[model samples]
Target chain A: MPSHDRRLIGAALVLLCGVAAADTVYVTLEKDDAIAVIDGATGIRTRTARIGKRPRGIALAKDGKNLYVAASDSDAIQVIDAGTLNVTGTLPAGKDPETFAMDPDDRFLYVSNEDDGRVTVIDIAARKAVKEIPVGIEPEGIAVSPDGRWVVSTSETTNMAHWIDRAKLEVVDNTLVDPRPRAATFTADSRQLWVSSEIAGTVTVIDTETRQPLKTISFKIAGVTPEKVQPVGIRIDPARRYAYVALGPANRVAVVDAQKLEVKDYLLVGQRVWNLEFSPDFGRLYTTNGLSNDVSIIDLASHKVTKSVAVGSHPWGVAVRP
Target chain B: MTPALALKLLIRFNRLSACAGRILLSSGIVALALFQAAALGGPAPVRRQTPAPVAAPQAVERLTLAYLGQLAEAAAVRPYFEPVVADRGVQGARLGLVDDNTTGRFTRQEFALAETRLAPGDDAEAAFKRLVADGRRFILVDLKPEVLRRLAALPQAHDVLLLDVSSRDDALRGGDCASNVLHLLPSRAMRADALSQYLAKKKWTRWFLAVGPAPEDRLFADALKRSAKRFGMKIVAEKTWTHSFDDRKTPESEVPVFTQGSDYDLVLVADEAGSFGDILSYRTWLPRPVAGTQGLVPSAWHHTLEAWGAIQLQNRFRQQAGRWMTEADYGAWLAVRAIGEAATRTRSLEFEAIRSYLLSDGFALAGFKGVPLSFRRWDGQLRQPVLLVQERSLVAVAPVEGFAHPKNELDSLGYDEPETSCRAKP
Candidate 1:
């Protein structure tokens, strides 16, 4: 081998070692039909691994070794080995698992089957579906509370978010909102939940304890059509001072003042900005611009798009590892 | 009298008084107004419905779309080649027509002539702008990239979607893209990718490339390289061929210069400028087939592409243009379809509403690519299945055979979402 080739191999090996030690977040871009494993500290996609058909929602196991991806079209949950970056197993899931939630212990997964109007609870150990909890039509945006006490699922067609008690697997309360309630995120304290409405172009703040909508923040960009700007995903910053909402079709992400319920700024990313993730250190934010076929990286402190990295086509749903 | 009974009596008396005489009509109107004032339902004022204004069909009547200069002015109206043309026959509607003389260079003398024939006086750009501003949105053009780029950059075109059926450049699909422009041509990259995919499937992994001596020829070469890298194909050898080979006495010498006896699975030619790709095909001594810009090629609209409801489209084009529609013609047709479909769905020509309907999930378009094509949010490039064609027949399509995105099945063929470099609000 030439001396330069030897040097190149040595450098690659060192870089590989560095990657192995660094925290990694594996995100399944369901629409892109691939999983982008991002380096959490770097905010860059380290590698991309292919999975089952129409993969949508993704959940990290408690151990953070296995990533579960719900392939809606294939009607299965693909289990990806984080270390090997390979699809290890496939478990039968409900129809159109567009969104999913993971239990605290990671022993069970709650998958929102959008087409079938139900949530399937899968036993992680056995790799089989254990139970099905019926929900409203086109169920999306499934999120479990940090305490593992409640599971919330949004039904787009019905425009409501159902809060289910994890233990009982029964609906404790239902909060109604404007049309096309797509996604929701809970505060660290679990006292409040923020839900984004895809159709009405608004976000509703709900008190988890009261199970009622507290406030609604409606937003619009000048020169942009009000109807086309459908909000889809929500992610709270690590400091919990602000929230980022992905405005679909408008190609922007709205930064919200968490307490005031006001849009602080609209960060222009690319066409059809749908899902987002924060870097492990909380210094950077990465978003999947579905139409642009790229990921936009935002510097958290600067609140500006620092870089745009090219990725696969129709990138949807992003995750960052800590 | 009780208030309710008094009001009812007053209303009835007003109706009776109106019929009595003109003098009674004034008294009846006054009494009815008084009754209405007492019967006010709520704090909000009653709103009167205003009739919707009817949209007037445009004057300057038919917007004339000109094709690339390669087509003869009268050729667009000929029926012998109608079935292959995409936009020729739209209900036999007679519209103003223009001709674009397609030259390999950027000189706009002929374009100037076409504009003159359109009767563009002083300030032609202003005239074009005024026409578009007045809701005459239909415009067919076959100008080069720079010309189209300039036209799209005009403030007037912000509301007008410029359909590019002429240039097949891929850069316009993403980073270099303009917001108001919609590309009709399946990019050279897309076509090359489709061809490379077919070769990869056939296990023709190694290739000998012959580049033509032209600037655009390099684009084809670049596209092939990208496809080769993407599909795990390798470039084993390469050579350049001139348009004329008068000095070369033997074909063996030319083949040896390209291959040098190195084993390659295929010979990929890049001669879009039409140098020597046609002659190089099937002339390789290695017995392997030739593909790329010539030989077994990938194209958008082929005469033999009768599958996937293409026959209907072909028939329509034949009826309109009176000839066969080429790939570029199909691109223009698809662009029109996009606007038409969006406008029909929204029931308005308002830019915002139409743009919204186009961006929505349900806005799917069938464009003879076997499946519906949609815009990628990442780069706004329309993701349509590419047809790997040869001699007016399809060999395969990329997301060919086994390519599938775990979510988007069509994503398997070309660049998927994860591979994109676009970011907005991170």
Candidate 2:
């Protein structure tokens, strides 16, 4: 059926949508405990696959064959076959997996066990937890460098990012940031890391080489209240030129000049935008609006919210791939 | 969210500047340095030599904050639905130490909260002296307004920093306000104002006010009346309850009769004791929403508040305390974090430096309420957004849209600069 569905999707790509633009947008509905699959070409939700308890983080595989979701309450990573949209397998993620990052080789996934105050490194092929790294409490934002040399875990209560050396699997350094750091993202070359502090309304750009913060960028939208400006999910583009940040509750995605280290523009999205993902071509950005219960598709070319696809309740995390 | 559970990361601390030699930090009597380290039983922080570019460590400074609270004399009867949590407010102060230590790990600072709860007939003056002698100037207090006033008047408490965590008496922030103490929890007036804003937003302008027999209930009712007037809401029907309707017995019949004559958009019950608010919620004759002490209550913390990074604190508190964090606990937590923020922002251990920085306009505490909570220079009241919550869901956060002030929107909640008689500053 998986192979049959892949052939149908391939046929649909050629018959309806173009090959390069046939990106499948998968959004995890936190409240609904389901993944809403949308056809990127039309910005329309095609399927709703019921997966796991409290599904938040959704990551697409390298070959675009599987989608791994962090089912927090289930304490397991539910893997879904991309073609069939069926849960194929499970990976042992520790208690309450908030989010995770896949290594460059896609061999491992560093999952943040929020309640456990540890990051469980899962071996994809083995389907087992390989190592547990003790971090600060309420560890939320997790990232693995594209080179697979470093893994960064940002702890909310600790207000520090514990830098894990990929080789040694040991925490070598810690950088203090603003209070309640929610999410962290590394640039394409993995030279720079952007961390969003939810409470402080600021994002600290860390220098990956020196393991130090380069600049603390504070956000202030003209009409938005300062308290409402909470930065959560951050993602840099394929070109690594512009970084997009989901400002929680403010309902705006901040466009940051990654090279220049400045907030270029703010694309107004939906209420309580938690996480976002860039499409295969990086031509569009999909934001999971938690409160709005919708997926806002941002046309990257125009930097405007082009379409809002209602994906049911609490759309938390989004991922797209060809 | 929380500190690490120490696993092989044993951080050996060289107390660079130990202020107190021998001090009873806790009832268990922990070593001054290991107070917070052992209390949380979280991983001992491992400090690296490489310093971060921004907010780097100045030097390893040992600081201690103390908790001063009074045990409730009479066992307060909570309705059958509520679970009784002992050591409620103190747990919040304890969590604050854990939180401070989280930042303390990177800041090269160690923090401890000396807990002292006054039981029946305990000497407040002697306990205050002991904390002061132990170099514990910053104390988070959850006491009655009168008890707080008595402690602040003590000669030894002159230079000490006392944070009022629980007392919601507006008079304490007004005439009875002390320059030494900073109010972390919002006053009754502020809570009423927070609720009024939400009511105004919803156009629930007509209120059926129900007041319990308790003295605190009356005070809360007073606040509700004031807020109603301020928000341009009409108290169409006001009633005082003197009837002793046992919660075990059928209040269904009694409550409807009591509320039958009233026609209002919302039922505002000011019952400080969990006396009859629950009984009034669904049993109201009009089937209108009940707010205030029971239904959609305005509070510092709620079990349902998972937004604006509050989930981190909620998760941490549940993991550590094995219970939900209460409003009193949230107040205590904020006081401790305020101390840490003040200390970290100024980067000094000097009493005046920390105290002034706390009161200064520059000092802002990220209270996980989607805002930077700061002290009102006029009344020493911590300005913060109030949470309006129901049983299992967060309804709204107050200082609701369009409820604005020329200076600070949070100032619009409680007594403003001109409205207050407390002149903390010249």
Candidate 3:
């Protein structure tokens, strides 16, 4: 074979791989009733899809072919096609669907109906609610375990984290946490669950096996008062090495060493930061700032906020395509 | 004494004795009936005759609260300043009852508010006795200090929990403190201190103090003086305004003259009524900012506040009342919400249970403020964030960034435990 032909084949293979690895970031602009898509490499918004009224929570499908958003005011889950960025269908959800979590296999979606005090379980393919499990009052945070065996819903007013058995669709245990729990996340190993309490200014860690609180991590900055250090949205890295917590009025993200369970640093971000997401390689973190109406991107290696990109009014939820 | 007066006094004493005797008898009968039911494992006849259904609905617990106030004439202010409703306190209590019921529907609890408005010169003591006689244990009082003290001292009010939602006099929480009374309104000192904190943070240390002629204005001025000292501010000059100005007559010519001979960073007015304070803002002698009762006033609730889910509450109140919420309304609402929170947490509507739960350390009510509001153990005053608001916008919130306390930061805006003169009776 000719050497020029071999070089041309190598170039073609590299182009194909680059196209396959293309990434896009989706953010829910809560007040604008739209979801913005940003090009991952350039950090520029490429497209926006108007989904529904008060779009709050966003999650991508396992295959990265579709996006699901919890439209709180509309009380439905809007399904969007990733390729065209258009609303393809709507799934029946409970009253005031605020936040949700999808199973690892993308077969089922668990939603928190804040006003009705119930968790609606939906079959993704059928686009209908399968079961309504009653939880505590003002349920806002919803999470499913990595092993797809358990689901947790945190209620704001009732101050309880209810653990639901996935297969049975029943509440198996209830763990009381600090006041006004807003968000929850499960560790990669499925051994521990972390819930953030906005009014209590703490993150409660619970053991999945025993279903008991293992530790409570409180955040305190040198110049900020304790009441202002509200923990709202939390994200644990894929490797489970670090936990990033968005402190709502403090305008800072707390970096917690997950292994040691200690707060190592506070990265200054935009005002009223609430939700957080990470890049596919865990090299960058994105936080949605509700008050400042922007998103802050932080470089994971240096622990610094690299840039702040302006979005719509009250950006709340974010999802990244892998 | 004259024979006729002596005879009248004797008749009144006999009537009082008869009323007390009747109350004692009714309470004794209720206690006996409760004991009989408990002893028989239920109310005897029904339980013995038929077995109740396994899925019988549980008896819903009902919480009754009362709002008592005197129907005094509205303040003689300009027509533009007229309130939408003459009965502000009762409206707040009614809205609070609705909010409680909204949460209660899910908790198997119900709440009802009983409103009683007295005519001018009517006997508040008699009206309060009537409410207690009707078995209302929680009462929200919007009466004057003297009337409230009289009601609080009545023997029939010993078991009742009174929430004062209108009076801002510190004396009620200090020298005249009552064992059964809890204060929801921010005291004069708290408001003054809140303003002083914001002013100090802005570095507006020099103040020109202007006071009105009324006694309430004098009291407010005294509170401002104390706050200035506490916050390390200096009063550069002082004056007393003895003139009155109407809307038709502008203060453009006289205000500058009245505020002359002062080099100050800001002007602090102590006008309790809406007399001349509004005229001092842009008409100050010096090109300075104005604060206190006129310009940047400190209040418990303002329409400008839209944070911490307050917009939802404001919208609800507007829909129900068809007007903006006032400070008195917010105070009354907070009082009722405190009771609702206590009942929901303990799952019991018993008076003693709710009272003890409210006084416990675990009791904190989210009052749409940024932080959880709890009563100060020293004086039974609700500790909360005070907002510094202009006419159209929220300027800032109190307990400003650098103002720290050993315990809660809200303590910085009011009397601390050490400084509190209230020897609260247990």
Estimate, for each residue in B1-426, the C-alpha lDDT of model 1 and write its tens digit: 333343233221101111112332343234333323332321231232111111221221112232221121221122333233222322111111111111100011111111211211123355456557556454444445655667767887766655565567766554466767666556777777778767767888999888878767787788788878888899998777664646854565675456556888888888775445655655577677888877887776776676433654565456546676666666655655555445444545455776667667766554655455666655555666676667756677665655435555555544456765433200
Span of ten consecutive residues with least summed lDDT in model 3 chain B: B11-20
lDDT of 1 by residue, A186-283 (tens): 87767678898775678899877666789998777865645446788888864578998998778889999988878999999988888877765565
lDDT (10s digit) by residue, model 3, range B1-426 = 433343233221101112222333344334333333333243333112222111233555677788887644333444444543565777677767765654554345677777777655677888889889999999999898888988888899899999998888888888888889999989999999999998888899999999988778898999999999999999999898886555555588788888889689999999988688888877877787788988999999999997775765677678778898888889999898889878877888999999988888778677778887888878888889999999899999987878888778999977888888888652
Candidate number achieving the greatest DockQ relative to the actual structure: 2
Name the 10 consecutive residues with the lowest summed lDDT in model 1 chain B: B98-107
For candidate 3, give the DockQ. Answer: 0.08
lDDT, residue A64, candidate 3: 88
Listed in order, each prediction's TM-score against the native is: 0.43, 0.85, 0.74
Residue pair clashes in candidate 3: none
Arranged by TM-score with the best first, the candidates are 2, 3, 1
Best by TM-score: 2
For model 3, how does the per-residue alpha-carbon lDDT over A1-322 read when each residue is reduced to its tens digit? 6756765664476456453244678999999999987876567778877889999999999998899999878878999898898889999987768799999889999999875668999999988899998776568899998977678999776677887767667665567677778899999878889999887789999888766789999998987877788899999987888999999999999999998899999999999999999888676788999999988988676677878888888999999997
**Pairs clashing in candidate 2?**
A137-B2, A156-B1, A157-B1, B4-B43, B5-B43, B6-B42, B6-B43
Better of 1 and 2 by lDDT: 2
